[model samples]
Target: MLTRDEALTLVKRHVSEENNLKHMIAVGAVMKELAARLGEDPVKWEVVGILHDIDFERCTGLTDHTLIARELLKGVVDDEVVGAIMAHNWENTGVALDTRMKKALVASDAVSGLIVAAALVMPSKKLAEVKPESLIKKYKSKEFARGASRERMVISAEFGVPLEEFLTAALEGMKKVADELGL
Candidate 1:
């Protein structure tokens, strides 16, 4: 049950590049939002999300990222959380993520990237300055944020919510803490 702050400190020590750190913060913001909306344990889930990519800095290849992250967090977090992180890039790790946390992690991880991309396009380059309409527009265009996996962002709907609605909820969650994200 580590707070996002504690996780950030740990991640900063473990991984120092600015973009990677911001990615963690973005994931944390979205994860906390998703947790609050779902009435789940926000701190725990967000901590899991914030640290999901903890091993990426040391990873030499995309295929090894998930396994590296798992190995790094093995003794430091709950088994469920570790499994969720390992399961995030199942295509790379061959891990099946069936838990709610895992599913949400997949969604938050992907959508947060899209949201941040959208924010950067805004005049203010801030999350609070971005709108659902703008995101929806960008989401519709096949070319927007080409790296963002739409398939992953759609995973939240599998848990019974529509993708657009999921995006709205996730965006609002991040916006609530936009100041921390510098979004």
Candidate 2:
């Protein structure tokens, strides 16, 4: 497995957009926290989260998304990590979500978006001011963070984490990196 620094270096090399990079960091922080809570390897899960979208800036279509990531990450990370990245985009790629890590990756990816959207709407525009309840409220209205699929977030249950608990962990995770995220 790649060290966190190496994974981040790879992400920076492939992803230049500021917001896109921050989004990866946010998902990674959340995945680390989720892994800790679930008694999994936090470093591995976090690395997977950070690298999941390394190909996003270069991707041209749904097929190019995870497919490109799989190619770029070959030999740099384990097959499981690569598979988790691809599994996060399972709807388009047909990869089965067979592992808890994969399910958490998918859920964390969507929840992080919803959390950021909620924080942006707050008066302080800070993750510190954002609450899990606010995320819960926003989760119901599809208009809020429309790109953050509620269906995907609800998959947290598959990882043995309740939806509310998952959202709270995600919010806390983003809050942990609020300074880096400028949120």
Candidate 3:
């Protein structure tokens, strides 16, 4: 049960992009929060999120995003974490069906991007300035936040959380360290 701090430190040793690193951290926080509420292992989920993009900055082209990460994390993290990381990369790893861990990873990965985009659009351009209603509107726009997958964000419904509620919770989780992330 590696802590999120351990995972972050390990990832930073291999990747250098500040923004990509921050995004990983933000997703880790959201995953930890969601895992806690879902009665899952927060540390494991957080580690999964933190290391999911360990090779994103290292991959040469767009085609093998998850492959690089998977290869890099091979002997480092636990197998379950690796699976969650791959599960989030549907384009590369294919959809991970009938698996709660995979579904949870997909949810955290997708929703975190939407929440961050909402923060970027805020007047203050800060995570604290983002609101739940704004997230919901963005979630349904389909045309908005073009890279965020609304379908992946559907995992929120599994826990009886409306998209807005899930967004708020996920945002709050990341905003806890907004200054650290510079977002």
RMSD of 3: 2.1
Per-residue C-alpha lDDT of model 3 across residues 16-130, encoded as one tens digit per residue:
9898898888888887787787788888877887888888877776577778888878887777777777777777667464466677677777887887788888888898787
TM-scores of all candidate predictions against the true structure: 0.93, 0.96, 0.88
Worst 10 residues of 1 by lDDT: 66-75
- What is the C-alpha local distance difference test score of candidate 2? 0.91
| lDDT of prediction 3 | 0.79
lDDT of 1 at 157: 78
Q: Model 2 residue 132 lDDT?
A: 79
Q: Relative to the unseen true structure, what is the C-alpha lDDT of residue 32 in candidate 3, on a scale of 0 to 100? A: 79
Q: Which residue pairs clash within candidate 2?
A: none
Error of 2 at 40 (Å): 0.2
The candidate maximizing lDDT is 2
CA shift at 18, candidate 1, in angstroms?
Answer: 1.2
The TM-score obtained by model 1 is 0.93
Report the lDDT of model 3 for residue 123: 86
> Candidate 2, residue 84: CA error in Å?
0.4
What digit string (tens of lDDT, one per residue) describes model 1 on residues 46-140? Answer: 89877988988888877888687777777778888888888888888888978778888998888888988899988889888878888888887
